[model samples]
Target: MSDNDSQKRAQFLAAYDEQLRTDAETPSAIKVIVQGPLRLVTFLNGRGFITYKNLGGADQAAIQRLVPEAMAYYQADAEIIRVEWKTRGHDHAPGMHEALIDNGFIRDEQESIMIGEASALAVDVPLPEGVTLRQVTEETDVRAMSAMQDEVFGDPVSDDMAEALLRRLAIDPGMELWVAEVEGRMVTAGRLELVPGTKFAGIWGGATREEWRGRGIYRALTAARARSALNHGKLLIHSDSTEFSRPILERSGLLKVSTTTPYYWKR
Candidate 1:
């Protein structure tokens, strides 16, 4: 990478760790319990989250101590089904990987953190002949969108996820749920979340039906979300992208600043 590229990646990484990774993840939490330097966030839908600004520059011994301390806090919560300890590749967290594993946390696949200017992604992308895109508002449409997404991802349709999304939409006007449909049947869906006080809007949960892949429909959906972000005055767009979507986002000018891996502990 060029010097300028390295500098830009460093800046993006710093801002992400400082802002979105800390505050954005905690705002919607049902309760935030702080243990030492970690934030243990409990969500309404039986999910627990753990994060911190930095591990206080802790050494291996400190990490070994801190991991279980944070895990114990989540263990006390009966409602939590599983907890995810989010790890960033660029962070200087000593012994975090080993510590989490020792505490029964299973490592999941890592994703690249893609960051770019929203304005660059707002350009029009031509859709297929019969596909249409729009922001969804009604309950039926939202539920349908969620079902389609779950099916695309090979997960069973979840009523709880749909209900949680509806509750979130009722309160957060900046969160936009979008989908693409063919002949009134949903084929693709995603969410564009505008972080209230930040310069970033996150594009998340993007999924397209198997039959709809490779026709640039997902790209069109991304452009739609990017347009929404631009309209909301968000300059930057962020997504924790899988291999399937990483190249698409990178093509739209997003840079892979870092990688994030989630370690899960089941209760």
Candidate 2:
């Protein structure tokens, strides 16, 4: 790719990645890395999730065996039956796609993995009338954020997940959730996370109410978080967005570097 194309891809990926913090939802698919023969982290919500760190040089066949074991782990739990295996395009994920497809995994739509300079995303966005932004720090604010996020995503209300997010916030996981409130109601929301070891910050769960759509609140919220990311010394901002978000981020000068497809399987 030419320099302009490369930069364009990078910008989009950076805008989609959310930061790491206690308030970050574990989503049952997040596995806390631990020591073992095959260290795996599984997150179980309505579905199962499997994420592993750099495998200890495990071959493809050994890696292939992991699914059944993981399936068994969540199989008995009534809450989980399906699982998503998130793959990074840059990772040496040998046999990952084949293994998943062989196990009845269906792939979701591919999304561009866009990453770019945070400064590029710090452009100004004008806020709509009676709407303002704030950083959520308290448990109540966290729950409210989670509730708004669910509504934005079109998921059923999940108090369990909402309460869980509040608990993480109470632990003070350094994650920041921001909302564009109209009058006293949250009409749009987003989260910013500064990853500890990487030069990146992620913005996630950006949503706006149907009636509140397209008045510049989402863009303004993104700009606010982009400014926040700069204060933390973050050089980049990233997010994995749906079609709705991808276009907005693209217009903001973020690049879409590569694509990520989540293939899911059920036990």
- Quick one: best lDDT, which candidate? 1
**Candidate 2 lDDT (Cα, 0 to 1):** 0.70
Residue-level lDDT of model 1, residues 1-267, one tens digit each, is 789878877887777877786768666788887787788888887899998877778889999999988887778878889999998888788888999999999999999999888987898999999999999989999999988988988899899889988988899898899999999998889999998788889999999999889999999999999998998899999999999999999888888998999999998
- Give candidate 1 regions above 4 Å deviation: none
Candidate 2: stretches off by over 4 Å: 7-39, 43-48, 52-66, 69-82, 89-98, 265-267
State the lDDT of candidate 2 residue by residue for 99-152, as single tens digits: 778777887887766566789889888777688999877777777878888887
TM-score of each: 0.97, 0.77
Model 1 lDDT vs. the true structure? 0.89
